[model samples]
Target: MSTQVFYFVATLSILFSLMVIFAKNPIHSVLYLILTFFTFTVHYVLLNAQFLAVVNFIVYMGAIMVLFLFVLMLLNLNKDTEPSKSPLIKIVGVIAGGCLIVTLIGSLKAASISSPLILKNPGLGLVENLGKELFGPFLLPFELSSLLLLAAMVGAVLLSKRDEVEA
Candidate 1:
């Protein structure tokens, strides 16, 4: 029953992810992405990672996707009105995407994984351990990531804001 549930959620997640990429309208794509995230959260729940699943649903499916939809609505980019690229450019993009997929698949296939990679039973101190590792060992990288995110948010806001002087 657990396996069946896992497979169902995983399949739905993958299908929604594909829809996110292939949807014609940006709003539909964002909605599909939220569905994908929700399905992934279900998969996480099936794996017994309840905290992670809730976090995924809240942070990604709820907050982040909502932000994306808000931006899409603000920009009114439901339809891509930009001029279409040439056939050669389209072909190049397809080739690049194919190469990226092939490379990722090949790397995953060729990677050597060790067995017994997880503890037989982890204690309920998962959050504490994660906090210790994130704040102590990975402090530098964690802080840098926050700074990067801040910079990205500032840059996006600046770029999106209309300039009255330009008008």
Candidate 2:
């Protein structure tokens, strides 16, 4: 029963993700992305990671999707404004996509599962366990990511700053 449901949701996730890429309208693409993120939240829940599920819902579905929608709206993309693609470009794109698919299939075939995944700690997804793990062995990487985020924030602010024109 659980396996069936997992596969069903996984199928939905894949469908929605493809929709995100193929949708003509940016807003529709963002909507599909949100649906994909929702499916990911369901996946986390199914895996019994309640905290991860909640965080995925809040961060990806809520914050990230909202940001994507906001950016799309502000850009006000229109098909009329978009330049037409050349037949040569289309052929190149198709060739590139086929190559990518072949690479992915080759990688998957070569990386056959060696062992079934076994959960070492069922409660690892809990906030307490997550905090301990992050602050313990993962502390350096964690702080480095925070620092990277801080640098990005500063860069955004600097880029957005208006230069004063002295009269």
Q: Name the top TM-score candidate.
A: 2
Give the poorly placed runs of model 1, Cα more than 4 Å off: 78-82, 104-116, 120-125, 154-167
Q: What are the per-residue Cα lDDT tens digits for candidate 2 across 47-91?
A: 888889999999998898898889888889889877899999999
Model 2's lDDT to the true fold? Answer: 0.91
Q: Rate the local accuracy (lDDT) of all candidates.
A: 0.83, 0.91
| Residue-wise C-alpha lDDT for candidate 1, range 1-167, written one tens digit per residue | 98788888888988998998998888899999888888888887766667777888889978888899999888887345756789999999999999999999999999887674465646323566657768998999999999999999999999999899986
Whole-model lDDT for model 1 versus the true structure?
0.83
State the TM-score for model 2: 0.88
Q: Report clashes for each candidate as comma-separated counts.
A: 0, 0
